[model samples]
Target: MSDSEKQCCAPKRSRAGRPPDPAKDQAIMKAARDLFLERGFSGTTIEEIAANASVSKVTVYKRFCDKETLFEKCVRKEIGRMAEAFDVGDGSSEGLEQRLNAFGLKLTKFLTRPNHVALDRVMGQEFAQVPSLGKRMFEAGPGQSRARLAAVLQEACDDGILTCDDPLRAAEDLLVLWRGFIEVELKFAVRPAIDEESVRERVEHGTRTFLRAYQR
Candidate 1:
């Protein structure tokens, strides 16, 4: 047998050993996220997160190099999940109002969550100190969300539902409608809770305003 033939016949490594528990990873990330939200990045500690997760300090260290790395991972994961929530449904034949309302409601619900509000606050407080964090937040969170929204808007435009020349800019404007209110409430802690009625009202009003400007 030639050396090349022998190499090609080498046994592949088995992945049969107990796979790393995704549940445990989720629990650890959730614990870290909550702690980071409750206390700003500087105030949160790895030991505190380990205790909250019911895992050993060594385990935490094995998973993440330090607080910054863990926080970045948590933020990126959360952003990806939020982006998934806005995935446009199969509504190609639906009325513009209906589609806009559905998207608006989903977006409002996401923005008004207490955890998301807490995350926004944490990012605001830390971004100046850690520039890379800002970049990651933009790329994974706002940037990704904007791109998704723009694609949907473009589709709507093509279907004659809207008159958008620049879907990206239009999407940004639509996002501003919900984001402005959330940012104000979170930054100042002015509103303790966003009731369901409030969420519905925001979505309805924002959707109407967006349609009015962009409708064909």
Candidate 2:
């Protein structure tokens, strides 16, 4: 079995005296995430999720009102776990270019993970059925990531490391630059899977280009 499969099956410890078991919640989310990625939203069922989680259908319902809600929670949980990609250091030490490179590498690598790519495909398919899912996922993930990167850029501007009238716009541009055609190619299987060296080269190129345009 794969590492992720093993992780899903691993026992989770929980605290006592809670009405809702955190362990059960983790199990449910793990099962739901795997099923959604493998089968997309429409194909996966609550019965399957409950079975995989070793919990009853009612237990799943008690934790999450519906399948849509459970899906959103799973996506949000993944996004929150990857949020540290935007850390970019304390801003008092790392140079703007260096920080951007670091952030770009982490962000792009996270975006291109097999599970994340699968999740994106699932979201694309489900958006037609659950219109609000796209909006909520964007706000919870990419929108929040952009805001964090914008704060980093704003800090650089304040420190005279860069010149930017709008940090948010700059952040978006940098993200687009970093993603480039790689994301499209990955999504469509137009090329072989990206390796660490290729990712680093792309990130470094983007960071340098961004600094050239924005550096004071």
Candidate 3:
């Protein structure tokens, strides 16, 4: 009944279980993305996704509210991971060219990936069917990434590394530089697929162009 005795008698804390299987989650997301891309959001069903994922409907619902929410989370997570891969420097010792080239390559690799491209197609096809889905996609994926890039650019400007008057506008311009090439690749299929050498070349060219325009 004493304090020490009572404390000792308290229930022991339960040890946390092993971390959730990331591979399972990834499989589910991948399956869902593939289905969405192949069938469009309206065509794809939770049952189909569950079957593709080799999971029960209950499991899928436990993780996501519905098909739209699951799709949003999957696409957002993919974009978020790619954005995190960009090495946006703190405008410290690393040269502007290096930082810019790194960012360009990272963005290029991400946008060119088949899955990401497919996700874009799915969104375009579904936007009319689910108007708010477009807004959700923007806020979760590109919008978040662009905001982060703008912040980094603003820091670079503050450090006199660049002369960006409006970081957001500059970010848009930076992205636009590659839009044509990306469209060509996806549409005409004329551009080469993304690879180490190709990515390097594109990054270098983009960095030079960016600096030419923005250098103080």
What lDDT score belongs to each candidate, Candidate 1 first?
Answer: 0.71, 0.77, 0.70
Which ten-residue region of model 1 has the weakest summed lDDT? 1-10
Off by over 4 Å in 3: 1-24, 37-40, 88-90, 93-95, 114-122, 188-196
- C-alpha RMSD (angstroms) for model 2: 6.9
Cα lDDT tens digits for candidate 1, 5-76: 223221233488655666766788999988877776777887889899988766666566566667878767
How much is the lDDT of residue 138 in candidate 3? 77
Listing every candidate in turn, what is its Cα RMSD in Å to the true structure after a full C-alpha superposition? 8.0, 6.9, 9.4
Q: Name the lDDT value of residue 125 in candidate 2.
A: 71
Query: How far is 1's C-alpha from truth in model 1 (Å)?
Result: 50
Per-residue lDDT for 101-129 in model 2, tens only?
77788788877767667667657777767
By TM-score, is 2 or 3 better? 2
- Comparison by lDDT, 1 against 2, better one: 2
TM-score of each: 0.75, 0.79, 0.74
Look at candidate 1 and tell me the lDDT of residue 198: 78
TM-score-superior candidate, 1 or 2: 2
